[model samples]
Target: MVTSFLLAAAAALLNAQEPRPVEQDGHVRPNIILINTDDMGAADWSGGGSRFIQTPHLDQMAAEGVVLTDFYASANVCTPSRAALLTGRYAVRSGLARGVIYPHSDYGLPQSEITLPSILREAGYATQIVGKWHLGTVPDAHPLEHGFDEFFGVPYSNDMSPFPLISQREVIEEEADQTQLTARYTEAAIDFIARQAGREQPFFIYLAHTFPHIPLYASDAFLGQSQAGRYGDTILEIDWSLGQLRQTLADHGVAHSTLIIFTSDNGPWFEGEAGVRGRKGDTHDGAYRVPFVAHLEGLTPPGAVSRAMAMQIDLMPTLARLAGAAMPDDRPIDGRDITALLQGGQESPHEVLVFFDNDQIAAIRTQRWRLVLRTFYRNWLVPLEQFGAVHLFDLETHGDELFNVAEDYPDVVESLSARLETLRSELEGLPQRETPLNLPGDE
Candidate 1:
C-alpha cells in the first residue's frame, strides 16, 4: 500500500499546477529524456575536448543547445550518485552514501522516499527506465516499484556478475550480450517514443547506458574504429545511439517537443580523460565533474555556454517544475531547480556543492572556491600519507587544485567547514532503516 504521506504530497504537487493540455502551439508538456552514460569522463566526448573519440551526435547537441561547463555528478561513484540524481536529495539521506550496491546486498532504495518518476507520474507522464539501474537488486527496490511504468535493462552495472537483460520483471537473457547493450537500449527507447507519438500523455525516459564502463564492448561495426582503441570505440557506439534517438524523435514529429539531457554518471574509471586532477572515486573535480548538455528544440537557445554550477540532484526539482509538478514539502531536497541556467541565465542555482567520497564529506565547492575537508585513497600507487586532511583552493586562479590556499584564506575554510558540520549533523539526524533486508533464512 502507498503511504499516506506520499499520497498527500502527490495530491499537493498535482494541485500546484494543472497539467497543460496538449495543443498545436507546441507549448504542451515536453517529453523529458535523460541519457546517462556509465563511468564516462568529463572530456570523453568530442565537444568536451577528446581528440580520439568521435562523438558527432553529442557535439551536434552541444552545438545546438546549452553546454554546462561546471556541471557535476552528486557523488564520485555509482549507486550514491544515482540515488542523489533520482531523489533530489543527497545520497546520505537515502542511506546509500557508503558504497555501490553489490549483487549480494539485499537492501535497495527505501520505498519511503519519493523519486522523480513518482512525482512525474502523478503529473500525467509515462515514466520508463531503459538502462543500468544500480540503486538496488531486490524486488522492493526495482524501478517498477519506484513508479517507473516500464523497466527494460540490466539490474546493475554491466561489469557485475550474472548480468542479465531484464524486460519488465523477467530475466530474458541469463547473461546479456554487452556488445549490443547500447544498441538494444536505444532501440527500446526509440520504440517507447514511437508508441507515444500521437498520445496526449508526455513521456519521461531515463535512458541510462551501460557501457563506456570497464570491461568495454563494442559492436562489430564499431570495433577498432578509433585511434583510442576499445574505450573510444565504446564511446562511438554511444554516440551512435544518441544519433538514432534523435533521428527517431524527428521521424515521429516529436523532436521539437522533447527535452534531451546527456551526461555521465561519474568520471572515467581506468580509461578516458578528465580535464581535472583525479579520476573516479576521488572527491576532486575530475571525479565529480561530468559533461552536461541540454537540448530542447524550442526552449534552449543554440550555441549557449554556461559556467553555472549544477549537480545531478538538481534534475528532480527542475524536471518537476517543467512537468508542472511541485516538490514535496515534507523532506529536505538538496537540489535546486536549474531551469533558468539551462535557458541561458548566467547565475548558478547553487551557492555551494558538496562532494562525497563514499559516506565521508570529502570536499565542497563554491563558484570560485573549493574546500577539502577529508582525503581518501584514490587508487594511487603512492602512499596515502602524502595527502592532507584539510585544504582550500582558489578555483578561479587555480582550477587544477594543485596549490593549497587554506593558509592564505583562513576565514573561507572556517565558513565552509562550519557549513559542512551543519549538513553532517542534519543528515545524521534523519531516520534510516535499522538494517538491510535479509532473505528468507539468512542469519
Candidate 2:
C-alpha cells in the first residue's frame, strides 16, 4: 500500500500544469537557453551607454524582451556568483564562499547539492552546458555527474595556465584559440539546438562565454571592428553570438516556445567602463549590477523595462516554478519565485541583499539604504563620512554612494543594521563545510 501511494503521488505531481507550455509542439515543458557573459557590466551595450562599441543584437534583445534595470549577480567573482545561480543560495551557504576553484583544487561544487540542471532533468528536460564550466575539474564534480548530459568548455577561466578546451572529460584541444572561442561555442550551440529540435523532450542549455575577462581576444574578423579597441571588438563578437542563437531559435520554429536570457556574471574587468563605482572584484554597485534581458513568447511583453531588483540566486526557483519542477525539500533555498515579477508584476521580490566580498560580509543593502561593515575590499567609503562603526549611504539620492548621510538618516541606518544582523546570524548558523581547493602537488 505504501508503494502504491508513493507512485500515485508522483503521478499527481507530474500532472501539475506549468506556467506555460514548455515547447511549441504541445509538450508539457518549455525550452530554456541562458546565455551568461563573463565580466560584462551594466552599461556595456550600445543602448546602455557604450561610448564606442556597438551591440545591435543585445540591444535588439532588450527591445524585444523585458529589460531589468536593477539586476544583480549574487557575488562579485565568477565561482560564487555561478554557485548562487545554480543552487539558488548564497555561495557561503553552498560551501563555496570564497575565491574561484582552481584547476589543481581537490574540491568543487558538492555533488550533494541540487543544481538547476538536476531539477530540470528530473522533469524530463534534456540538459546540456556549452562554455565555461568553472565550477570544478574533478570527475565527481563535473557537469556530467551534476545532471548535464554533455559538457563542452574549459574547467576554469581562460587566463588560467594550460588552458585546454575539454569536451565531456576529454581534452579536445591542448590550447584553445581564444580569438575563435566565441564563434566555436556559438556554432556548437546551433548544432545542439538543431539536434534537440527533433527530440521529443524539451531542452535546457546554459551557455557561459569566457571572453572580455582578461587578456582579451577577438576573432580576426572582429579585430579593429570597433573604436573601443580590442575590448570593444571582443564585446561585438559576443553580440554576434547572441544574434546567431536568436536566428537558430527562429529557424527551428521554437522561438515562441523557448525562453532566452541574456546577462553577465559580474562587472567589467579592467578596461571596460563600470558605469557605477568600483570594478570586478569589489562589492560596489558596478561589480554587482549588470544588464539582464529575458524573452519569453506569449508571456513577456516587448519593450518592457522593469526596475524590480533581482539577483542570480532567484533564477533557480523562478525557472523551477515555470517548469513545474518540484523544488528541493531538504535544503534551504535562498532564491524566491520571481515568476510574477517576470510576468509584469511591479514590486521587487527582494527587499534586502547581502554584499559578500570573498568570505567576509562587506555590506548590506535595502531598497534605498546600504550599510557597509567593511571597506577592505572596497575603500570607496573612506572618502565619505563615516558613522560610529559603519558607513551608510542613501542610494535613492546618492547613487554613487559618495556622500554619507548617516547623521541625518539614523533611523534608516538602524533598520538596515537590524536587517543585516538577522542575515549575518542566519548565514553563520548554517552548517559550515570545508570548500575544495587545489594543491601544488595534486593532479
Candidate 3:
C-alpha cells in the first residue's frame, strides 16, 4: 500500500512538472536581426497588398511572422528615424528632428545617448551593423563608438557613395561594387554569427539596405528582373538579401534562436515617372506610414497580425525587453516596450503618438484616429505661432484620408482632440533646463 501511494504521488508530480497543455508562449528571448530599408512604402510587398510589386520573400516573412500593421517610423526622414530606432526616443528628444544629415555633416548622434545595440550588448549580445549609418559623419558618431562591435557598410547614405569609402577613419576613392557590398555585408554578418556561436554568445545585426533609395543601381542579375522595372528589381534584390540572411541562420542551426525585424525608414520617395502626382512632400499617410514586422525564430506567432500602434521609437525598448536589457537611467528614454502587443497581448503602445515637422510638432494618433495639424507657413515670420488647425481622421476605417473624418465620428474627434490639446499645451510649456539633450542639434 505504501509503495503504491508513493508511485501515485510521483506520477502526479511528473504531470504537474510537464508544461501546461495551453498555447505555446513565444515570449522567450532570442538573437536579433533588424533589416531597415530606406524610403520603402506601405504596399511595396505582395503580402502588404502591392499588386504590382513582386516580393515573394517579404510575403513569406509576413506569413511566417507577426505583421505589425500600425507601426510608424519615428520620423518621415532618415536621421531622426534611425535615432528613434536606436534610442527608442522620438527625434524631438534625440535632437534629430529637422531633416536628414549630409555626407560631411559635422554632427551625428550623441554618444551620451544609449543606443539599441548598446543596450543589448550590455546584456551580452554581440552587436554589429552592416549597412547605412547616416546618423552622423563625425568620428565620435561612428557605429563603433555608438556600441556596435563591428561596422562594415557605408558610414553615411548610399547616395554619399558610388565609390565606396574604405573605412570611417578615411574617405578613399574606391568605386563600390554594389553587388559586392551587399554580398560582403552578408558574408561579414555570417562570420559574426559563426564567431559568436563558437564563443557561445548571442548576436544582433542591423542590415540597412541602400538600394531602392537612390541613384538606382542594380546588379546585372537583379536589374530589370520584374515588370515593375528597375524599382521592382531593386525591391527584388532586397528580397534576395533577406533570403540570404535567413538561409545563413538556418544553415547554422540557429535560425530558431534569432529574432529578425524588417522595416523601412520611411515611405517611398517618388522620383521616377511614377511621380506624375508629385505629392511625396504632402506629409500625409503616404509620406510617413511604412511596413514593420518582428520575427523570433520558432517563437513568433505564424501569420499572426498585431494592429497595435508601434513606431521606430518603440524598437529599442522592445528589443531590450526581448534581450532582457534595462532602459537607461541617466536620461529618460521614450520607446515603449510593445513586446506584449507583438505577442498578441497589448492593444497599443500608447494612447497616442505625436508626429513632427521641423521643430514644430504636427500630428497625433490614437487607436482609431489620426489628427494632422497641417500648420502651413512659408517662413517663421508668422508670429501666428500655430497656423495649422488639426485634422481628425478615422485612420482604421478611411481611404485616401480625403474625407472629413470628424464629420463621421464626431465622438472620436472630440476624444482624440481633447487629449491632443492637453498634451500639446503641456509639451509646449515643458520647462527648459540646461541639460545635454536641451542643447541644439546641428540644424
Off by over 4 Å in 3: 1-28, 161-163, 166-175, 271-282, 375-389, 407-415, 425-443
The pairs that clash in candidate 1 are none
Model 1 — which ten-residue stretch has the worst lDDT? 1-10
lDDT score, candidate 1:
0.83
Number of clashing residue pairs in every model? 0, 5, 3
Q: How well does each candidate superpose onto the true structure, as a TM-score?
A: 0.89, 0.89, 0.83
lDDT, model 3, position 162: 40
Decide which is better by lDDT, 1 or 2: 1
What is the lDDT of every predicted structure here? 0.83, 0.79, 0.69
Q: Candidate 1 clash total?
A: 0
Per-residue lDDT over 68-134 for candidate 3, one digit per residue giving the tens place of the 0 to 100 score: 8777777767777788788887766756776677754577888777899998888777888887888
Residue pairs with clashing backbones, model 2? 22-29, 22-30, 104-438, 105-437, 105-438
The residue-level lDDT of candidate 1 at 317 comes to 95
Tens-place lDDT digits, model 2, residues 337-386? 87665655667778888778776677777767777765533345341214
